[model samples]
Target: MKIAIIDDNSFLISSIKEKLSFFEEIQVKYTANNGADLLEKLDKDHNLDALLMDIEMPVLNGIETTLAVKQKYPQIKIIMLTVFDNDENIFNAIKAGADGYLLKDVNPHELFNGIVDTLNGGAAMNPSIALKTLKLLRNPVDFKDVSKEEINLTNREVEVLEQLSKGLSYKVIADNLFLSPSTVRKHIENIYSKLQVHSKLEAVQKARRNNLI
Candidate 1:
């Protein structure tokens, strides 16, 4: 399988490459320091099967990058990698259209399985999502429990909004969060659905109007 990775940390990128080095079936076609770089490479060719992305970066953030990638290359799957398992980040990523979510500390084998599953038409969410779900269910929100509508958004979806408001790009955001550009996209989709809005600008506007932040 062919894959692309866009992250700022050269070391982490190398480590990931090494971890998958033994798998002859997996080929790392392109690697970039940020989302903009990934787009540059993609302009030359768009044949990647999957992307492993981070949520934060400097030039373009994971969320924005994912949004752009999904717009241009919807066929490829994206999987996010992060150290944070917060509700916002999780929801936002799902909203962005990510195929799966995995923690940085996840077992390599599990990561492998997640990658395969995502490529095979499956969704992957970090186990932490259940804890967040349980918490929300217990406490409930103050806003007439619109939480169900919000449920359509993933943790990563929230993360994307937080970042996008700051006017960050996918590449820069990915670098900050140590993820690839493609994975950043999946979360944006969830954000749209949860907010009951379409397009990035609309989602941000609605969230602001509703005081969703």
Candidate 2:
């Protein structure tokens, strides 16, 4: 399995490389200091299978990078490998199309398994991260005193947002609404732009706060 690690700290990158060095099947393709550098490298050669991305970095953060990568190369899986497991970061990473979420302290075996599972279409999340994700989905973050902005969403967009709030994937939402996945994605993009939110959690919470959903 070809993998790329992205982190601002050189020592952390080296540490992750050393951990992965235990696995014979896994190859450390390359390492980048930040998301911008990674994108430039990918533009030249994007044959990577997965990326171990750090959340906080200069030039471009992991969540923004994940969104850009998913839009450009949806085939390559991305696992957020960060030390911080806070709720905001988790939701933002998920909203940005992260395939998996793992902490930097994960054991080598667990990290390898996460990569394998993600490649096989599983949401490879650390046990704690998984629990947090479930909790966030069940009871989303509350935004107090959110501005009552008049965000105009079409009927179809509202339907899509409702499905998103239910924690449904794009494909499933498209199927349920009898729309193409691409169309659903476009609607979501519009929703994000109109609502000025970067994450599904934010969108849902704001919509509820404004009584749009």
Candidate 3:
């Protein structure tokens, strides 16, 4: 199986490479330092079977990268290999189309199995992560009541957010509002903070639930 590993830490990438070396059936195609780097590489050669993605990286995070990769290369499977097994990270990674989630401390054998399982069209996850995923599914977050108090958004911010909900690009939104792309991005950043959310999807969903847009 051809596999690619992505992580900011060179040592960690080396460690994962070393672990994967034990499996004769697996071939390490290449390693990337971050999501943007990985995307650039894939643009040149995207024939790999799967990817070992790190959740925390500069330029583009794992969750965001996973979403982009899945949209552009749906055939490739992605497994989040990270130290974080937190609820938010797990939830976002899954939502972003990760086929698996494994902690960085996972045993080599288990890691290999996860890759194999994912390639076989099965979802791979650590035991704890699976339990947490089950819990999250059982008790999903209610975005409407996420914050007890009202979330106050400026009229300009609201206009930007409404544009965002339409799936318009930042440049397009900027043009519509007669503002610079950087200004639109700033509005989005502020919107994320005020909504206590991260991604555009989350922000839009929360806003809709709260009738903010």
The best candidate by TM-score is 3
lDDT of 1 by residue, 1-213 (tens): 899877888888887887778677789998988888888899998899998888766688677788888999999898887655656556666667778878767766777788888888986666776567467568754433343243334556677787777779877767766668776766666677677666666677557646665
lDDT of 2 by residue, 116-199 (tens): 999999988999999999999999875232355468999999999999999999999999999999999999999999988888
- Candidate lDDT scores, in order, read 0.75, 0.92, 0.92
Model 3: per-residue lDDT, tens digit, 1-213? Answer: 998999999999999998998999999999999999999999999999999999878788898999999999999999999987767788889999999999999999999999999999998899999999999999887533444558999999999999999999999999999999999999999999999887897788669757899
Residue pairs with colliding backbones in model 2 are: none
Point out the worst 10-residue segment of candidate 2 by lDDT. 141-150
Off by over 4 Å in 1: 130-213
User: Which rank order by TM-score, best down to worst?
Assistant: 3, 2, 1
Q: 193 in model 3: Cα distance from truth in Å?
A: 22
Per-model TM values vs. the true structure: 0.62, 0.67, 0.68
Instruction: Return whichever of 1 and 3 wins on TM-score.
Output: 3
Clashing pairs in 3: none
**TM-score, predicted candidate 2 vs. hidden true structure:** 0.67
Where in model 2 is the C-alpha error above 4 Å? 142-213
